[model samples]
Target: MSATAQALRLWRRAEEDDAWRLLRADNAPFAVAVLAEHLGGDDRRVDADELAEAIDADLDEMRSYGHDLPLNARGYLTAWRTAGLIARRASEGARGETYELTVDALAALRFLDERESPRHAATASRLASLSMQLTQLAIDTDPQAARRLERLRSERDRINAQIASIERGDADDALTGPRALERLRELLSQASEVPDDFSRVRAVFEELSSTLRAKILESDATQRAVLDDVFRGVDLIGDSDAGRSFSAFSSLVLDPALGSAFEEDIRQVLERDFARELTVTQRRRLRGFLDELKIRTAEVHDVITVFARGLRRYVQSQDYQRDRVLRTKLLSAMATAHAAAQTTKPYTPVGIDLELTSVASSSVGALRLHDPSEYDAAADITTHETAAVDWEMLRAFARETEIDFSELTANVNDVLTASELPSVGDILDAHPATQGVASVVGLLSLASEYGTRGDEVEQLTWITPDGIPSSALVSTHRFTERIP
Candidate 1:
């Protein structure tokens, strides 16, 4: 057990000890009457004699029992003729001065005296109090540290409240029943009979049984609002479409990526009620979404690299200003061609269009180094211009920047060469929804091609609702596209 746990156990053992029971003769020297008399009080010089007479024998006996010199009783008396139990200060004033318990000692004894509950509770209460005091002390010593401690204390209180609620079964508490609950045991036995999906079933059942484990922690509104502002700067996503979007604001958190954090947060909430009322299809769907998420992560990473390169190009060059008109003309023409091409029914290409559309280049124009006149110094401008550099010079610069030529530039040639990337069809084939189909090129492009090639685009490309016939869209009233 932890030190806190051990101390709690000892405190509880002591709380269960009642003063009346301790005073019983059968309790002997360890009895309350003997222990009580050892407490002394500041009763002045006259009452000192009486207090001394009453406690002297008990003190001597306790000292004989190996409690030795300057025990609490001796110290109390030396300090004040009176040192006694704070609770009995009234009618037993004289007796009180004769022998009384210290606050900590009283707390220990009270913990031992409990018959109503575990003594650990009293210990916990006292420990919490002491801990708060120590916390306050540290906060006083460091002003900046004080602010963080306040946040922690608020978090601690929230957690404590949640724990209390669970213990009381007030909110969404699920764990219930006696040790070795018979119902749970029987259910497990039945679940084991079907061996194929044991792990999944057991996990669901555990989530169902133990979902009350969220620690019931909560922060205050003021702190909550402050945190709201801080995290607002973070695009924390929950169950909405943003959560599913790879581009969600939360995905950009530097400290800890919020996409993973969101998945984990929602998983905790759902895990609590996993098997409670969940359908088999729902379970499968959840698992599928998680699997899809993992696969999509790699796709997102690749897309990030492509975009990063685009950004660097934009930042380094005069892109839009130089290429805007040409790009617009090309994009418009391409869109028209694509729109018509998508409808090309009988001519639908079944291959992996492993090509990034000529769209980006259409906007930028061709890349080439040329001089119409052979005598022109186009190649030697580097020697005359202020801001001048070329590709070969760049390669040399890279070699110079690298600390170790042998290690850093060892495979630079291979890295510089571009490799063919995996195709779109390959990616879609890996997904569960479309995995059964070995060929996806036709499935995805069929509608678009039909639209372009067929005489009636609307009739060819529009989707009728599930279970409804295409005949439903025959009416002129409900179509997005009306062109024949």
Candidate 2:
């Protein structure tokens, strides 16, 4: 079938499908309301039992409204799945199955629940969007250099006019409160729609995969030819309209600087006076919508990765060889059957049953125990008694070696008060080393704390407690005298 015809058929199916019809049913509003209340938040999927309980609770309140509600939540979900309003898939591990709204279904529900903006329409935002779309379309579709040049010239003229207006003090043309609110609403709406688009793109990719698999299994072509066709089909999918849009969306979402800028802009908007008009829920929704888009983008990428891996495995496995063998066996059997039919009075079809068994059994092996005595060993050891400490000798050693930091600090401070900017040498000259190198280190520490002068280096010579001379290079410092 032609691409146009296929698209038309799909559109017609969407319009006339039982799922679409279900949306028009009286109970649909209630069903959609329940879904929106229970599943419309951050959750992409809900457990069947949890969804049932939620539905039952909603039905309890809804019963007072004299409306009949479907208590069988699972049945309702199955119906919706059959209609393409939602999808049911086996949950991971042992969590049974889960149901999530399909792209079309979500769009439908969002449209139904959409309300008119309380703020005035933003002409600037609308015009800007239209202008951007037109410019992009022109650039993409028109390859003529003359047309491109003309577009550039026109854009320049528009920019010049805006600049002139600004210079003329026509700042009144700036966005007003209502218009800003409208623009904010527009941005929120666009962001909210991104997740649905990702869901649609994922669906398209999955459909493409299914088509490729079917072709591989049914085609009479050689394995190489089939593999080539599969690759070409995959490329075609990646270049499709949905694929291109999703790729662009992913790039935008993943760009750190752009994401940060967008978040900052949203924060700025939220702090505006007009933002007070928005309810807390609305504010949170606007703020969180971008994060949700990022999550959806990640999910789409994950799906693509999984699909690529599965496709790679399918190609590498070379199942076509087994398929050929099976075909040959079937042909041989048919020929044998024909020969037997010619000789026998009557021929009857016989069934064969094959029993398959695992190569390994599920029995556990015996555990081995180690003897403690084999690992345990005792070795001869020498022991020393605790030595008695000489308290007087330790006191003498500490008194001879101990450097007083407080006395060093007082001496350094005295030198700084006497000199406008003192070097390490000057501090040493003012106070001769009593503790030797240790006192020099204390002076350097004090100079560092006082702040260094402009690239001035100083050499300091000090004697150790044992009378050995040591020299060190230190940055000269300018110290301001502390006020009383």
Candidate 3:
């Protein structure tokens, strides 16, 4: 059969499948809606407990509306998985299986939730998109250089005319009122879909990685050939349509200057009269949509980076050489076995039984225990008499007294009271070191509590009792007098 006929047959079978029927079921809409609301964000996987928590309120509402909803979310998820609408897989290092909406299920959910009448701005934005896509297609497929050059010239002329209009302070070309709202709506829709795009891109990278790993293990190809195939697969993933789109999206979203400009533009747009007409929920959504885009883009970039690192390690370690060696050994062993089987008297395999004893068990009877009676309980006790403490030595050991921080604080207050605004040096000069370096530390601590005025520096010098000079460099301290 032709590939087209096979595809058509498969499509027809899918249309009549139990999964498709489940999607069309009466309760499917509610179930899908709940799933989308919960697992639609950066988190693509939902555990049983999380799924239950997310849909409990929605299920209750449905029950109140006289619709029967699934009480056990885990069972509901299992049933969907059995029907091929959802996928359940063991989560890495996690106890329970994680559930994710299969591609088909997501498509079906999207179809069901699609807007009957899309936002007003969607029509014009779609037309612009279509025009852009057509232009790209022409540039890609058309062989006429003159026609492409003409198109470019026309575009440049249009841009020049717009610039001239702006130079003349013309207000006619500016977006406003309903038109501005439509554009804003279009932007919001695009931004909201970015997370979904990221999820799809990440899924593709994971699938590619799995395929490369399986090929490396099972293929009987040469080491160099295997390595080449792996590298080619990596390149294809990085250069594929989805990969290219994600690269462009991430570049734009991750640009520091562009991100800043986007935020500033959003702020200015939100202040306009047309923006004021939007509902609070719509306004909030627009405000946070760019932030969500940056976050999702970062996550996708991180996942791609990790996958690339693992791929590089696999290639650098020459793992394919080991796989090729293992394959050769297996082939050689199989050939030897086949040759032996064709002999007049084939080597008969026989099992041999040998008794073995562990060293611990063998030495068990040889171990001798010390007689308990030989070890007297009183003989085991050894005690030393406590020595009497000398009061003079104890007093000498406790010679160092604790420095009082309160005293340091009071002294700083006194100096600042007299000088109005004293630097750290001034405070230290007013209070001589009674506790050596510790006293200076206390003064600096008190100065820090009062706060510094600026980046001005002050040097404090003090002499220890041993006549060693010590100095401290401190920022200019602003001392405020205590009110009480």
Candidate 4:
């Protein structure tokens, strides 16, 4: 394309792009700040309610500072969603929804991060890394055997010379402090892009999945072929270009030797005196980089697997055909309506009154059982004079019916004060259940509020009211610190 044409194309694309739109939005600073604060770092996704609560606090703070943010957090979030900056998804195996930054929003955030912490374009470390990568690429891709061999021999000679110099006690060959910091910063900057890259990869798989489903829906021939492949146990999504690329990335991230080396390097770097100059966040990211990468890689793999299986199941079932039929009926109705609109006035009422579909009517047997006490009232309800309160009797009644959570709380706090994380069983062991199973239930409730749950179940033993030993297997829970 010519320069003007190419420039015009790029300008149109920029106008349409969500990242570009986010950067140039009216409340760009406010939006970006809120999004980065909530969705950045390890908390890449925040629960919908939690995100709203956090942003609501931020809005209040900004409003106190004389900003004109009239809408609440949910309202702003909805607007941002419409603008394609944020996305909401159902949380895995959890109630309610979660909000995450869209791929474009992640890109914009990354851009802002890089802009804030500017890296020199031509730093020595960057240049050296690029040069080394290019040299390796050249050596690996060279077609001529002689040229490749020559490059290999030259590399071997350089390594041998380095070994000889190191053997001569050339400790001065180590990188200077400044140079090492520069390299470390460069590595971190590069590492920062990885999260965005993973987001993009996931987006690509999602798009590819949609495209495949669209193809199936649009073409009967393609549907048959896809079904045949699926029945043969072929993974169409995994065999795609995006899938292959992610597969390679997953393999690299999961590699044991590479992981070990990366971890060791991080440990060595952290131990260096120069590392003290690095921020806590930088140090933490470096330490957890490999493990996080593996986790993200596995998550992406699961996404691919889920999409593939869902697509196959969609095709194998009659859902698509039913949907196709529904689509046809809706379109036909639209056409009929259009035709009628040409002849009849829009305000004119039709003869028919449409009723919406609803649940089937059932007898009162499905309703709650009626209680005479709930509705009954005495014909003459005489009021009596007030009397002195019976505190001891009230206490006896409460002790008989209530769970005695105050006692349970004391038990839990006593156990937690001694142990960093104590389970329900631990609390019971430390303080036997005074209220029998009621105390156990109360302890579990307290644990649910303040403790972390484990996968394994543990048997909680307690003495019954009659002094018989009672036990029940319950999911393990651990508490940290005293529950004040």
Candidate 5:
């Protein structure tokens, strides 16, 4: 492509990409500060409400410092979510939803983080790490067994020499001062990218799954091959580039030996004298690096698993067929409309009237501002002398509310003596509900625990304390004997 063509493509991408859009936003600095303060550290996700409250407080603080933030936390969050900088999802067993930074937003945050403290392009620790990886890759990939054996022998000899020197107390602590810090920074820099990688992998899987669904809904002919492959247990997603890469990464993360060694090395590094020079955040991050990697890796693994299963379920349930039909009808309608537009203006009145679906929308200016004073109660209280406790009145009140279980048990037993497996209605008929519905309710409660209930319902009638007749259809319960 020509330079102009390439530049146009780059411009288009920048316009579409969320990370670029976030960076180019008017309040980019404000958004970045809030996001990093709340969710940029150990917390990958925060409760939606909690994040809004936290951001609201920060907004107040920033506004006090002469920042031009007019909107509240919820307003900013809504905008950011709509713009795809932040994502919200329902978490399991949580009271409300949670918000997390999307992969693109993470990328934006990472860009800003690096800009503040840029990594050297060719630092000694970075170069040495790269060199060691390249050497290992070359040795491992060597076609000739003899060459691989020779490389392994050389590595073993070097290790032996190092051991001999260490045994003779001639080895020096070269990684003590500045060198240790450099390597630590390099490690931290690399570790910082892992979370973004996991997020990217999850995003790729989601997009892939969506693409597969779209393909499935294209047409019957297109779906046949896809359905056949799916039915035959072909792991289309797990076999994909992103899926395979994540699987390998997860395996490494889950490896017991690798995890143990990584943890031990981190501990030893943190205990070193050079670690004292590191900031508290850096030290904390280093200590939890392995744990954080495992968590992120597992999250990616879960996303892949969930998406794969959902895709399979989507296919098996034949939901795509309905979607395909809907799509076809929509296209047909659109085609008809397009043809009609050629003959008549859109505003031209026609004999046929179409009802379109719509949502309720209103102007923000129409909303009424809440006045707390309007709802506040400001009545003064008047003190009165305490009345003497009336024991008889209290007992009468308790009798009215409390269920008379003994009377209900006796009624059940009396009814049972006359007939075996007497239903609740039979017992109520024998004892005319002296306590009205309360007595009936007491009997039903006892029957539920000590007797059997049937699907059949019977209308039981009773007179209330005010002599008003009342009736209700309740499930039939039979008692075989007197309540114990």
Candidate 6:
């Protein structure tokens, strides 16, 4: 299935079972559920164009957050958005699709994760109460009141962290990422007596939340104004003001006189720094994907370079070992997988070993010494397989073209008119560089057919020059628009 469609399928699966209810409560869960609701059924069969647009918009939204929002606030928003539960809507005119709250989004609110579903409703209500209490604390001004406010704000953070952990899987590193306040709360509550771990957890959360909250509230109007802009798209605009005076705010909030000195000097300061760097949720994770792509590209390139060096050394040394060769090959394959990601895998080696014929996993074996035909066929197979990989690489390179040509859009459009083969010129028209580029486009079309779950996006055409074909050149775009 296409990414959107597959996501839609996942959402439906969750919703039909009443699981989607938990998603709408937060941004990440909302994104995932939103995708499902927007593209459910026929939508799960979203066209390539829509997928392209959704991804672009998501990236754009994230960029805005990073440049404008405070690091701490941005981190929280990112968690909420990347949960991938929000429904994406296709915007009219120049705009593409956007995330809109939907039925599935509501389901996200009722999120009953595999473990947290039972407490979903109860936890949500408690969270609301804690949020209110923190607000009250923020307004209070007495010296004793400041300490109590810090305690309450820390509690509120713990609750928010717990909700976050439930929406995202445990692999999300909720403990390190967001202070694991909620988990720590449960940990403290469950213990018979106050253990070192429990005390440590509370101390850590209290310092982290209070320190960050104070910095944020004390932030100058310029910073606060930027903060307001960061959360402009999101509805949660907590008391914001331009040119707001915050000098009255005590620096002691972060560098305190009353709180734990050791905790303040070492842990609290470090914790504040970490919290500030945390990425918040945006309307989409499009920017995250782009950053990931850049990182992944760098990693893949390094691996490939290492492989080339290894191959050169091994070939020169003539110290041939099957295990070593296979290991190199495996690393090379993994590099390709990382680079292409969803693209068709380049090669599936079938290693043969005479001694270990019983082994299902292929091993190294020389060709039958006397069979010429078998040798020729095997050589042809190797050539074919090798050629396919090169083609895929070229396609990937070309696709990193001037624009991120949406695979989703291409997949949705290409196969609408099956049996009508696009001409050489027609294919070339979409991309006009060289024969190599043309070949890549062809492979891309064919790849989309196999990669996508359904045949709607798969198109095949027949072009007979002298014999006189029906349609001279029907581009994939035209194919999608055609009523026939």
The RMSD of every model to the true structure, in order and in angstroms, is 36.0, 25.2, 23.5, 20.9, 16.1, 27.7
Question: Candidate 1 lDDT, tens digit per residue, 1-484?
Answer: 9999999997885555433333332433443443333431112112444555656666787778786445444454553323222222222235433233434333334344344333233333355557878876766676587687886788789889999998888977555433223333333333222221222222233332222111101233223332232121222222214234434532443225655675685465446533445455544444344344444344334434443344333322324334545666888988888888777764678576686755555433575557778766666555554676688998766443322223212222222232222122222223221111211222222213222222222211222224332211111111111112
| lDDT by residue (tens digit), candidate 2, 415-473 | 76777766668777888877776577555555555646547677788887678888877
Better of 4 and 6 by lDDT: 4
* TM-score comparison, 1 vs 4, better candidate: 4
Please report the TM-score between candidate 4 and the true structure: 0.70
Candidate 5 residue-wise lDDT, 196-260, digit = tens: 77778778998999988787787474236566556435677888898888788889989999999
Off by over 4 Å in 3: 1-22, 41-48, 69-71, 81-100, 115-122, 132-150, 169-171, 221-224, 227-245, 305-484
Cα misplacement distance, residue 149 of candidate 4 (Å)? 0.6
**What TM-score, over all chains together, does every model reach?**
0.20, 0.57, 0.54, 0.70, 0.70, 0.17
lDDT of 4 at 105: 96
TM-score of 3: 0.54
Worst 10 residues of 5 by lDDT: 219-228
lDDT digits (tens) for residues 320-378 of candidate 4: 77877877799899999999999999889878987879755598766776788988886
In candidate 1, stretches whose alpha carbon ends up further than 4 angstroms from where it belongs are: 1-155, 161-172, 175-276, 288-290, 314-394, 397-484
Off by over 4 Å in 2: 1-18, 24-26, 92-96, 114-128, 160-170, 222-224, 228-245, 318-484
| Model 5 local distance difference test score | 0.83
TM-score (C-alpha) between model 6 and the true structure: 0.17
Q: Name the TM-score of candidate 5.
A: 0.70
Q: Any idea what lDDT model 2 has?
A: 0.71
Task: Give the lDDT ranking, best first.
Answer: 4, 5, 2, 3, 6, 1
How far is 392's C-alpha from truth in model 4 (Å)? 66
lDDT, model 6: 0.40
